[model samples]
Target chain A: MIETTVFAMQVLLLVMGCLFFAVGTLGLFRFSDTLSRIHALTKVDNLGLGFIVLALLPLAPSLAGGLKTVLIWAAALAASATSAHLIARAVHVRPEPPEAKESADD
Target chain B: MTLILNAVAAFLLLTLLIALIRIWRGPAPADRMLASQLFGTTGVALLLLLAHAQAMPALMDVALTLAVLSVLAIVAFVTRVVRIDRPSSGRKAGDQPETHHD
Candidate 1:
């Protein structure tokens, strides 16, 4: 039935989303530079989240629930985009960041 | 479907473990902050997966809040840690001519 097919697609999307998330995390280990790591984390992870959200849409409890699900995706995307730019800008402003002077890192 | 969602959520946690390694090995402030960003985002996805798998609607609000807080964390790092305002004032005139503007 069509419902079965949709279910299968959802499962596939969910698995693929997890794979993308893993790949994004992999960038942190593989890339030595901070900006390069950010490049991988921000862009790929958003794609991963998008896939996961798509998979979950069919399971939403109601129309309101579904819209809220989509809204989460939108908010995450905006956050990632803005933070990526901000982090990149921060890096640009200071090629060398002082990690030792701050307590936040500890 | 619920089983698969739970499995996917578990997989995301593994990714978070990898990001933790990045944090442990960071040589720059941005690198560490980036690891935390990964944490925030991965946490969001994990919450969503659980919300569906466990049939809990309130977790969605939690995810939204997490997203907002994560971005705010980045902003804090920029303003307080990296101190974004310093570049314009700290440098001498005609030093690194390309950098001093805005």
Candidate 2:
């Protein structure tokens, strides 16, 4: 019974993770500008990956395996945050060409 | 459970393909890079799921490596912009000096 319950929970988490990831992609499509899209992608990377990690923990073969998986999540979050900052800074430092229509968002 | 894992992994891949459309339609360079970041994050998740589905724990390491590498893509994109824009930025400083304000 306990194993079955865990499986159920895992399934739920996996679905949630995938859903948030889809939403982030939707933001990429619907948001008018690059900055807003960046905001949306970071959230999905953080939250969606977190949920997926949580769901996968139960499948780990050992404690070390679980720790390694969690570490991946931490590393991913760190990388995502750092990259988003760099990209946003780049966008700010060098606004798109003046003639470009999308740069008008600036 | 393996079936469900495979299904979810497929769903993630589908979303990834959808994101590719954004990459294609990018009106700004940053938008293209942002979609690239999306690919990195989603790829990590996909690898993790596949690791379990295939019962190959080593894929976990691949996922970790991907997680680390994804950041590099954005870093390169930013530095690439900054390197090319530095001289002009110095000139534009006078017209709109917003750098120090932040």
Per prediction, fnat is: 0.71, 0.70
Docking class of 1: medium
TM-score of each: 0.89, 0.86
The whole-model lDDT of each prediction reads 0.84, 0.81
B16-77: candidate 2 lDDT, tens digit per residue: 88888877787677777776578568888999999999898888889998888888877776
Which residue pairs overlap in candidate 2's backbone?
Answer: none
lDDT tens digits by residue: candidate 1, B53-86 = 9988889999999998898999888888887856
Candidate 2 is graded, for docking, as: medium
Q: Quick one: best TM-score, which candidate?
A: 1
| lDDT (Cα, tens digit) per residue for candidate 2, span A1-106 | 9999998899999989999999988888888987888898898757998999899999999999999999988888888887788788777766764334345433
Q: Which candidate leads in DockQ?
A: 1
| Residue runs of model 2 more than 4 Å from their true location after superposition | A97-106, B82-102
Predicted complex 2: DockQ: 0.50
